[model samples]
Target: MKWTIYQLLVMIGVTFFMWGMENINNENLIAQPPGEWTAVNSPLLTFLATGLLITGFYFIFLFEVKKKKNRFQHPVWIYMPQLCMAIGGVSFVLFLIGGTIGPLGGWVEQMRSLLYLILAYFLFLIFLFIFSFEHKRNRSAQATEKTIHLTFFWTLMLFFGLFFLF
Candidate 1:
């Protein structure tokens, strides 16, 4: 049997999806008493599931990019969108599906919070877009540095978001 990175990534994605589904459904493969803390009901599990799914699809897109023999001079820039998408998408999903049930336990409260989170995420997207566009236009060291800075900024945002969410 032949294996490729794509296949491996897909399998890992599928595994993550299955586990996430089980977690969401509150079904544990392990035997435990009913009133216990399981990862099933956690918001972080939902976030992880959403992020992993995005990552899988991104890898498939990368496979297509490679298939066309289009090489990136700055691979980090290419990955920035994936990171942005994963975080933004997860935030949206968490708000939509698990919002009221999460830390903020009311629809109105969650919606208000969502508004701010969305606005911040949108701002980050805009900055990323501008940096990427400028980098492509000028291919300058400064532009590249700004894009890398944005990536790090996004990662830091991810950690803070998780901390607050959890």
Candidate 2:
């Protein structure tokens, strides 16, 4: 599919909106060190990164789908994000285990924060995968099935993540 500049811009805007909401929640505030200026964490960064990932995959999947091609010979550059996603998932689980079973107090608190960040990364990857898959599939016939799968996956992940967060 040919993507117009307008479509890309719209996707960027949507990504920024989603990322901003995720990163800038007031409830998760952390205090800065004395005499240090607090930096604003824009969730927009996460959104933009995620959006780019989804856009790339969408373009690849669209090209393949439109051409009716199913060759699985993905190049190294195409697989890099998937590798990063796997690393992020493993790191998240490790952080959760280390935080819960390894220590107490400050160390655990720090680990918990790190775990949350990793969870956010994992969620972003999940969104990228789902959005790409949905864009590739026959929307009318498989929409419900795909939605159910994504909902279940996200629900399970969010439940476990929240359990670790609090």
Give the range where candidate 1 is weakest over 10 consecutive residues by summed lDDT: 63-72
Q: What is the TM-score of each candidate against the true structure?
A: 0.34, 0.30
Q: Candidate 1 clash total? A: 0
TM-score, model 1 to reference: 0.34
Q: Give stretches of model 1 more than 4 Å off.
A: 1-40, 69-166
Each prediction's Cα lDDT score?
0.52, 0.49
lDDT of 1 by residue, 93-158 (tens): 876675456664464453543443344355455445544554455565553444444534554456
* Model 1 lDDT, full chain set: 0.52
Candidate number of the best lDDT: 1
Clashing pairs in model 2, backbone N/Cα/C closer than 3 A: 19-43
* Model 2 C-alpha lDDT per residue in residues 1-166, reported as the tens digit of each score: 2434444655566456545554654356644457756444433443454444444434433444334233422344345446656766786676677657765336636544443344455655665455444334534556433543553455445545654574
**How displaced is residue 87 in candidate 1, in Å?**
18
